[model samples]
Target: MGYQYQLTKVILVIIFWSLNEVIPIAWVFLICGASLPPLDLIISKDKYLAQFPWELYLFYGYAFYGILFQAEQHLIFLGIGYSLSRLVLYFQLKQSLNT
Candidate 1:
């Protein structure tokens, strides 16, 4: 009975800790994904907006989150994902302009 109780407690602690770390990362990705399309539309409609350094602002925001949360790995992954998505958007916009 004692061993079983200890095992259960350990499992619960691990689960909760994992969730605490995961939930924020999941939220970041979810919000970024949801916002991208609308932002892309707005930027596309306004060529001058594309000239703005929006990506730098995003990087600063991500860096702020990292500083606040002390989650270096999450910040690195977020930066990579954001850069790739922005690159894709840039190429798509360039192509559209050419046509």
Candidate 2:
């Protein structure tokens, strides 16, 4: 799971960097900054961390960022990537729990 998480982060960085031609540097920074906390939370085993609503925060944060910047397309792309990353984390966590 740790390796997978690291890989996901690396992949996301690559994807975002490649989008530098399209997305502004500020947007790229915002997206990456907004994503790290939730990713960190996903790997934590703390009971308090499990109880926090990071998902809602991530969604709302992205929405707010998009609206503020008036970038719906970037928002949508961020949503898709974010959802896929969360799904990967979810499955990894679930597998670990079941074992």
Best by lDDT: 2
Candidate 2 C-alpha lDDT tens digits along 1-99: 678578658966885788687878556755764565465664554632244336657776777787788766666556655655555655666677779
For each candidate in turn, the TM-score is: 0.40, 0.41
User: Per-residue error at 46 for model 1, in Å?
Assistant: 1.8
lDDT tens readout by residue for model 1, 1-99: 465445544653554466666677654553444334334545354642355436657776777788788867655555655555656666677777789
lDDT values for all models: 0.56, 0.62
Residue 60 lDDT, candidate 1, scale 0-100: 68
Worst 10 residues of 1 by lDDT: 30-39
For candidate 1, the TM-score is: 0.40
The number of residue pairs in model 2 that clash at the backbone is 0
Off by over 4 Å in 1: 1-40, 47-71
lDDT of 1 at 77: 54
* Native-referenced Cα lDDT, model 1: 0.56
Clashing residue pairs, candidate 1?
A: none
